[model samples]
Target: MGKVYIVGAGPGDPDLITVKGLKCIEKADVILYDRLVNKELLSYAKSEADLIYCGKLPNYHTMKQETINTFLIKYAKKGKVVTRLKGGDPFVFGRGGEEAEALAKQSIPFEIIPGISAGIAAPAYAGIPVTHRDASASFAIVTGHRKEDAEEEVKWENLAKGVDTLAVYMGVSNLPYICEQLIKYGKEKSTPAAIIERGTTSMQRTVTGTLGTIVEVAKKEQIQNPSMIVIGEVVRFREKIHWFEKQAENAYPVSGVL
Candidate 1:
């Protein structure tokens, strides 16, 4: 039986993929990659490798999760090295755990290669640190998406009063609801907030505002998904140390999306 490697492709930039992850792609006989994964990295794969697209969009899934699991099993059982490449750290809201569980049930041999998650990488690219020595001592990564009409399970109370910083992913759609929950749970309306769009890439755009006004700001800027929402005092540091935006100005200048 062949082995399966579930690798994180990193957030946006192709160069950020870990060495081991790259090696997996180079050696794999079959590769199943996701939508957010940077296609540029595929150039490293063997020319004979079979590339399969498993891209998923919000409210739409190009390939079902079950289908992906079946493909991994089928490829590995055929004695072919299989690689399942995801956009961010496999376990970090990338559904890597689910895939791992599927493999375990089938007794497939596999290794998980971790990649930099967008939650942290996006903020850093936008010149916002998720954690700061003085302003923030704690951090949390949260999902902005939720089931329609489902009961909310997020602990907004603690998130508002306890956590020093919050990195919210895929939350552009529910920005207003998120802000409302935070404030309803005791977070100050004037608390700093920012969203980094297409972060870590040449097309990166960052917009900042307070919890009270971010909704309007986002509407005006037309920010969309694949963005990171950062909330906390650490966001204030952007004004003084925002480096990526400067780099883009001098060298990278907002080029078209990759």
Candidate 2:
């Protein structure tokens, strides 16, 4: 039986992929990649490699998780090296854990190759540090996408009172709800917040505001999914250290809420 490699493709930048992740792509006989993965990275795959698209959209799935696991097992049993390339870290909201569990049940041989998650990379590219020496000392990565009835799954009170910083993924659609929860749980309405869209890529854009006005700012700016929502005092540092946007030829001016 051949081995399987679950690799994180990093955020949106092709260059952000780890060296080991790249090597997995180069050596794989079959590659299943996700939607958020940078297509440019596929260039490294061997010419004879079989490329498969497993991209998924918000509220839509192009390929089901069961099918993906089946494919991995099918390829590996055929003695073909398989690479499951996903955006950000495989285990961080990428469903890599489920895939690993599936493989484990079947006693498949596989390696986990971690990639930089957007939670940290996106904020850094936006010049918003997840943790700051003076402004922040605690950090949390949250999934903003939740079922209507599962709102209580996240500990809003602890996040508001205990955490110093929060990086929310897939949150653009639920911005208002997120802000409301934080505020309702003791977070200051004036707490700084910023959203980085398509972060780490050339098309990245950042919008800043306070918890009280971020939802409105997001609506006016028309920010969409695949964006990172950062909340903390560290957001204030963006103005002084905002470097990546400076390099983008078409970077938008940072919109701030008064």
- Most lDDT-accurate candidate: 2
- The regions of model 1 sitting more than 4 angstroms off are 147-154, 252-258
TM-score of each: 0.95, 0.95
lDDT of 1 at 245: 71
State in Å the error of residue 140, model 1. 0.5
Q: Count the clashes in each prediction.
A: 0, 0
Worst 10 residues of 2 by lDDT: 146-155
Q: Kindly report the root-mean-square deviation of model 1 from the true structure over all alpha carbons.
A: 3.0
**lDDT of each residue in 108-219, candidate 2, tens digit only:** 9999999999999999999998998999999999988756555463577788889999999998998998899999988899999999999999989999999999999999
Tens-digit lDDT string for candidate 1 (1-29): 99999999999989899999999999999
